[model samples]
Target: MGVIDWAIVAIYGVVVIAIGIIASRRQTDTDEYFRGSRQIPWWALGFSIIATSFSAASLLGGPGEGYTNGFLYLQLQLGDLLGYGLVIALLLPFFVRLNLTTAYEYLEKRFDAKTRSLGSLCFLLFVIARLGGLLYAASLVVATVTDLPMGAAILLVGVVSIAYTVVGGITAVVWTDVLQFAMIFVGIGAGIWTAVNGVPGGFGELWQVAAANDKLALFNFSWEPSSVRSLPTALFAYGILAFAVAGTNQQSVQRYVSCADEKSARKAILLGWFSGLVGVGATLLLGVLLFGFYSINGGLPADIAADGILSHFIVNAVPPGASGFLVAAIFAAAMSSIDSALHSLSTCITVDFYDRYVQARTNEKQSLRIAQILIVVWGIVGIGSAFYAASTGKDLLEFLVTYTTMFLGPLLGIFLMGVLFPRVNSSGAFYGTIAAVMLVIVGSNMGWLTFPGIWRSAITAPLGMLLGYGISLFGQIPPQRALQGLTLWHSSKQAQALGRPGLEEEVPDRGDY
Candidate 1:
């Protein structure tokens, strides 16, 4: 990167910090800090949701997948769309009506305290592990572009993200995400333009090269259960992966809960799908560009390994000033995810743990302080984990991504059992989660659950959910009033009151900056 690129990165950092400081004033209460006082514009929230979900993993990992494996990876996203649709149709209404602060709180309302706490604990572990990987990936991009030490770069990114997240809360996260999303598009567009302009045959030549190398093929339509990358596995297994991510994950669910109502939430979710499709398309295009650039140039630099395609091209292929912008774009991808994780983790700890146990009658000011402090604490933990991951010589991003999925199958199973199977008692849900998680661990160790050849993991959530529900069914009690009490889909005065516009009035909801 040239001096101009450094200037751009410095300016971007300043703008993000300023936004965080400005948003600090709005962090006067727990509700505002956690949910943005339910006042964010649906468009901004929608874009923010896209930005958060499209992490460094998506930006870099997607292209890497394309470069190595072809368009077969896009099949995973098919289930992703279905997952978001399901969330909009089912989960959004339930969360909006209840005015939830954290996603796991729904478990408490439907089951028992133990279920809620267990769910929250799973989310906490997943976010920290995943956020560390995001930070590591962004730091690696910085290291490649600017020739900085990876650990130092990781620390730098972590500190800047934490500075804003601790102050700005949800408001800062959403607004800054809009800017980050724009940066991502600009970077992708610039990369695509450069690729096309430099190539002899343009897009046609690019597609021919990819197809010649077996990178352009999309469908793998086959139903062999043991075949990992077959069409059936990509459609069904990846579908389950998408459902687990969009429907039950705290980070995605929190975005919906922050919306004003179910209608707005639905709109936001639908728009998010469009944003995701555009983002994925751009990422795939970038991969094709990298492939063409390398084929024409007789392959990449020696230091540019299999996983470093995007970073290497942006640094070596793009002009000096443009490299900086691409770096900023990479930073945007990482921060969008890390900041949201920090915000959600803090919210879960504060609302789910501190408020529920530490101080039941705490005032707004005290709640806000606890939340800010927890953000700092979790940020430090993530940074520490990044450093440890770096020293261990493991692929930080891959490790984080795989570890997070280990929890997803179980979490999805627990939630589905609670919501769809009313007979699944608190004990059943709790034990079912343990069993599903154990199966994941055991399967992974036995190599029966290795990551599929495709981009997404192959250990389908449906199998886990079915196993959990099956287990819960055996312990089912006969029809009783207890089942009726557990029915969240049934209407009540509380539900009707929640349906009213002034429901926030009855709750005296305090508010984010």
Candidate 2:
């Protein structure tokens, strides 16, 4: 790396620290720390959501997927689109009306404390798993370019992320995410430009080479669910996963709730989903370009792994200044995602467990301090888990998908039961969750399900809902009074009775927003 590249990375780090300091001055209470006082603009939250959902895993692993597997991976976006729509129509309004601090709070209000704890537990597990994979992905670029040990790179990324997230909280996270996304977009553009230019002909040659080798291929209409990129797996399995990630996961839910109002929140949700589509498309195109570049340039070395392809190109092929900028962008992408998850996981722990069960009467000042401490704790845990992730030797992007599918389906199922079937009591939600997870574990291990790991959510989510609903039939239906403002059927009425405006009540759009 040249002097300019190192300077750019250093400048980016300074700016990140400055943002944290600025945001820290504004956070005096838990509400401000966790929800940004419900005053952040929609577009900013939208960008944060996109950054969190896409992360370093997508930024790096996407091109890797493109290089190794062609366009088959793009089909996952189709399922994710449907999932976003479901979140906006069915889940967004309810979450906004209730004005929750965490998504799992709905579980407590709708069922019992135990169910809420279970949901929180599931989210914590998902975050740790996801955080590890993300850290590993980010470290690949750093290690490739700077010759840093993988563990040291992970530590550097983890410590930096924790510093900003702990001080700035959600407010800092959202605004910094806007900057990080810009860097990531530029980095993608540069990668594409260099990859295409590396070939004899630019776009024309890329098209010819990629098409000749089937790198431009988009669809795999195979019937086998075990095929990772098949249309059915992408459409059905990924569809369910998209909903769980966008609608049910705490990371996404926190972004929606932090918006100034339901209108802004809905708009932000749409912006996030659509922006993600564009981002995913760009990364995949960069992959195809890489394929063409490598094909004509004597091909990739046998020693490099798929996940390391983009890093290899950035280090060896790109101009010095731009290469450094791209490396910094990878860090930007990692920080953007890592900060969001850290803040959200900390918020989940504080609100769902600590505040609710341990110290209900603690003042806001004490609570905020506790929350900051948790961010550091989780940051350390994340760094440690990344070593395990690196050892697994799976493709980073698919590993992310597999991690999400493991617990998210049943968690989403519990939410569905809470909102759609008031008859499903707390016991049903609890047992149903357990049964679904066990089924997913056995199916994944025994291979009796005859489907790929991505299909875990699609197959099990429905089973969880059915099983939970059936169990509810044998239990007492929750009192209608208790169900008010918590379930779809009663949300409107309870919202009015509680003097909080229902989502149906539209607010005039202010130009300032």
Q: Which candidate is the best by lDDT?
A: 2
Model 2 residue 450 CA deviation (Å) reads 4.3
Tens digits of per-residue lDDT, candidate 2, 425-500, equal: 8889889888878876887679775567777778777888998988889988776544666677876677678765
TM-score (C-alpha, index-matched) for candidate 2: 0.94
TM-score of each: 0.89, 0.94
Best model number under TM-score: 2
